[model samples]
Target: MIAIDINKRIGRGPGSFRLQVKTVFQFNSVTRILGPSGVGKSTLLKILAGFITPDSGLIKFGDAVWFDSQIKYSKMVQERNVGFVFQDYALFPNMTVAQHLHYGSDNADYINQLLELGELTSLKERLPRQLSGGQQQRLAILRALSTKPKLLLMDEPFAALDSALKIRIMERLKSLFEEQQTTVLMVTHQDQEWEHPKNQIFNLLSQED
Candidate 1:
């Protein structure tokens, strides 16, 4: 289980608001985080992935204490073994699709499987700049899965793909996640129609709520 109680201040004055999150995320579940534009939805994922730190909080995942504000203890991003697919894709400009997956894991067979799964086998030799927006997004997701991370965090990961491709990828990913029992936290403004028994929704409401 992942339990957290975090608080962070965003912006200043009238435009500012406090993002206070207190919740427990069950294991081996897929959670879709929803909120208004600037409600700090992405910030929550960032904090969980150790990319950002909250002003005060206690983050515990099973036996691991990811953060403890009172003790000034916080885990580094690398130490968390999290796979993150940013909204921008965050791919290496010079690395080809194959190279990206290989960088995550040295297993040749596993890498090849991921390439096939993402339908990126033919584009294996293409670099980020050479691929289309949707292709780049696929490579990003594949690279994240290369390591079989315990926690997968995605920020608007499907925004680049069309409805058909988006649904197809999500379907494949759902089965893969179930097989690996990987916990996923995806940030999206709209809910995808696909549903799974382990799927969950985390709605971050306005401060007034």
Candidate 2:
């Protein structure tokens, strides 16, 4: 399990609010963050991903200390063994689908499996610019999943896909996560996205209650 008890004052002037978050993320489970916009959902994900530093507090994952403000220790992003899926589907402009999948992994068998899972087998040679919005989203997801990360952090991961396609991929994605035993923390605004009983939910605003 991972725990985060931190505070960061976001923005400035009258518009800013201190993002005070204290929560525990269970290991080998999917936790969906739920809250209104500007409630620090994505900010919380960034903190866990090591892209942002918390002004105070500590973050511990099992026996590893990811961040401890008092001690001035912060684990590097790559060393944290975490995968991040950006909301904007950060795909390479020049790389094809195959190249993206093969970026970190040379396991052709595993690459094929992810391609099939994402229904991108036929589009493997296509670049991000050539693919549709939904296809680009799938490619982004596959790139992250190909790593088989210890923990995956996603921000509105399914925003581009239609409802039917979202459900279809999510079903297989859940199975893959289970097989890999990957811990996931996702920020979602859609109610039906990964709406399963097994997943945990967190309301940021009510986190202190």
Candidate 3:
């Protein structure tokens, strides 16, 4: 299981607040971190992903210790083997769809499966600029998944997609996650977006209590 126990302080301005979060995120299931804007959802995810360090407490994934403030030990983001998909679907403008997937892994079979899963088999040669917003989002997700990461961290992954496409992509992601049994931790402002029973939804507001 992926266990998290951390207290972080962010935003140097007067609006900043101490983001104290502690929770155990189970593996082999999707965990939705639901909250309103400015709730430090992304901050928490970043800490877990090793993009940022916690001021105190510890974080562990199964037998591995990702972070331990008391021990003064912290792993680098890349060393954590965590995949991240940002809100804007951070794709390289110069890279083709196939290139992005190849960056994740050299396995041709895995790349082909991801391309088929994202429905981008026809657009493999196209650059990010050539694809639609929804297509870009799918490609971004596929690239992350292709890495075969132990944990996937997503920040508002579907915020850029339209309603129809969001639903379709969500369905595909759910199916793929189940098939792969990859652990996912996603932050979303929309509460209804994670209505699927397979996912364990946890509101940050409730988590604070």
Candidate 4:
């Protein structure tokens, strides 16, 4: 289980608002987080991933204590076993598609599988600048999966892909994630992008601080 009871202050002065949430996310589940613009949806994911620290509260995932503000304890990002796909598709300009996956994992077979799943096997040697926006996005997702993390966090990861490719990738990812029992937390403004009965919607705007 992933339990989060945290409070953060976003921005400074008059623009700042209290960001507080207390929710227990189930294991092996896909949760899509939604809220009004500037509600700290992405920040919440970063905090969970240990990239950002909350002003106060505790964050626990399974048996791991990711954060405990009272004690000033926060786990490092690498030790959190998290795979994150950022909104900008944070790919390295110097690295090729194959190289990106290789950097995260040493298993040749798994890396090859990731390339095939992303439909990037043929373009494995191409760098980010040589690829289209959708291709770059797919590569980003594949790079994150190279580690086979227990928890995956994605922030608007499908914006570049078209409807057809998006569906295909999501379908394939669903199979792999189910097999690995991986938990996913995603931030998306579009509800139609993820239309499935199994996906739980965690609407931040609907929750009281």
Candidate 3 matches the true fold with a TM-score of 0.90
- Ranked candidates, highest TM-score first: 1, 4, 2, 3
Q: What is the C-alpha local distance difference test score of each model?
A: 0.89, 0.89, 0.83, 0.89
Give the poorly placed runs of model 2, Cα more than 4 Å off.
Answer: 191-197, 206-209
lDDT per residue for candidate 4 within 1-209, as digits (tens), equals: 99999998888887778889999988888899988888889999999888888999999998889999888999999899899999899899999999999999999999998888999999999999999999999999998888999999999888888989888898889888899899999997664646667768898863333
Off by over 4 Å in 4: 191-198, 206-209
Steric clash count of candidate 2: 0
RMSD of each: 1.5, 2.0, 2.3, 1.7
TM-score for every candidate vs. truth? 0.95, 0.94, 0.90, 0.95
Residue 74 in candidate 4 has what lDDT?
Answer: 96
Candidate 1 lDDT tens digits, 1-209: 99999998877777888899999888899889988888899889899999889999899988899999999999998999899998888899988899999899999999988888888899899989999999999999998899999999999888888988888888888889989989999998664564566678899987842
TM-score of 1: 0.95
Candidate 3 residues lying further than 4 Å off, grouped into runs, are 191-198, 206-209
Clashing pairs in 3: none
Write the residue-wise lDDT of candidate 2 on 1-209 in tens digits: 89889999888887788889888888888998989888889999899999999999999998899999999999999898888889999899989999999996899999999999999999999999999999998998999887789899998888899988888899998899999999999998764656667678988883321
